[model samples]
Target: MAVAYVYGAESRDISAPYSIWKVVGSLLFIIAFIPLTLWLVKKFQLAQMKLSQSEIKVVSVQSLGTKEKLMLVEVEGERMLLGVTSQSINHLKSFSSNARTFATMMDEASSPETPSSTEEKKL
Candidate 1:
């Protein structure tokens, strides 16, 4: 009976430290897992963005009113101007292949035009 009681006490003492270690290891694993999972998700999202980079691009956007906007989008090398409202999106214009880019148009608008050589000769 005494040997049996000693065996039980020894087993309990051995298991107590191991059980505490197990709980601590589990808690540490959980703490590490959350950030690791978040990091992996962010990496995958970045990879997807890189893969779809050139498919469709938004060149510019303008807000007309509270719920209305104008969006210039480029898709497959074609540029389109779209008017967006709370209710619907309407296609305002489709640029031709030879049409100038938005930056060129802005520059031309901002710069003062000078008379040509022919105009000067005529004058």
Candidate 2:
């Protein structure tokens, strides 16, 4: 709008002609936004799909390199370690139901000790 105003002032034309380039650029952005928005929405949907009740979930991920990773995934209460690379994904190991997860260990470590429990143990 500023650029158009300056052009109009310089030309001394009351009805300043709109720049074709600006109109074309604006139209291009409008057209491009739809696909860009759709792509972003699709990517977000795929990311959110990783977790759901009664479905497979990625518990944790360890990146080895740009395209290599070790992922711990849970499916139907069974946890499995998978080695992922650019070529393919390989199953490393399977964990049983009684296995202690990293989350459980972290929770135990971070939890505060009760004063009553400590006094009882001392007694």
Candidate 3:
């Protein structure tokens, strides 16, 4: 029916109704276009963000309230405690990489239960 309609339209037959192929083609274009456009947008966004230059990495974030939170951020080799609110973000304190805070984090990452450790605990 759609092929017949298209053939009639191409032949300038005014009596023929609209083609189903036109509607299907439009739907297919929209489906393909949306995902392709979205992927391009995401690729563009990732390209714009320089991960290497972003030295301040968020180690952890804790919510205190609906609009207030605490964040532990590592800037260069130093770690800092941050107070975050809806209006602003403030640095509460800064500590060196050798600080107890960082040592504790390292200890947690390489705990006894981790598979890589060959040493067994003596009872």
Candidate 4:
């Protein structure tokens, strides 16, 4: 009979201390994870920003892809680009020309040399 009970014992009480500990542990895990989850969400939402500094100044914003959540922002004179991965921001060729037409810019205000051919005296 003892051997039979050992093999086919009634289910243990789920309301026991071990069960209570499991519930508490699960709750603690959820609570602890909340802030980290929120932080990652916030990080996901931060837009990549770039500024151009020229007569045709521009600013642009782009969303990082799920696989490309890490962005590289580059500013060269009045040109800026955002890339999944690149040697320079120059890779960012998509600019809101509507915005660029109005906000001549860059982060460091570097003025690239104007094309010498375009400097002819006005008639």
Query: How much lDDT does candidate 4 score?
Result: 0.53
The TM-scores of all predictions, comma-separated, are 0.48, 0.51, 0.46, 0.30
What is the alpha-carbon lDDT for the whole of candidate 1?
Answer: 0.91
TM-score of 1: 0.48
Model 3 CA deviation exceeding 4 Å by range: 1-18, 50-52, 61-69, 100-123
Ranking by lDDT: 1, 2, 3, 4
Q: Find the candidate with the highest lDDT and give its number.
A: 1
Candidate 2 Cα misplacement greater than 4 A, ranges:
1-17, 24-54, 103-123
Residue lDDT tens for model 3, 11-94: 765433346667788999999999999999998888877555687788888899999999998989999999999999998999
Ranking by TM-score: 2, 1, 3, 4
What are the per-model numbers of colliding residue pairs?
Answer: 0, 0, 0, 7
Q: Which candidate is the best by TM-score?
A: 2
Q: lDDT (CA) for every model shown?
A: 0.91, 0.86, 0.82, 0.53
Q: By TM-score, how accurate is candidate 4?
A: 0.30
lDDT of 4 at 30: 97
Instruction: Kindly list the per-residue Cα lDDT of model 1 for residues 10-77, writing each as its tens digit.
Output: 99999999999999999999999999999999999989888885768887999999999999998887
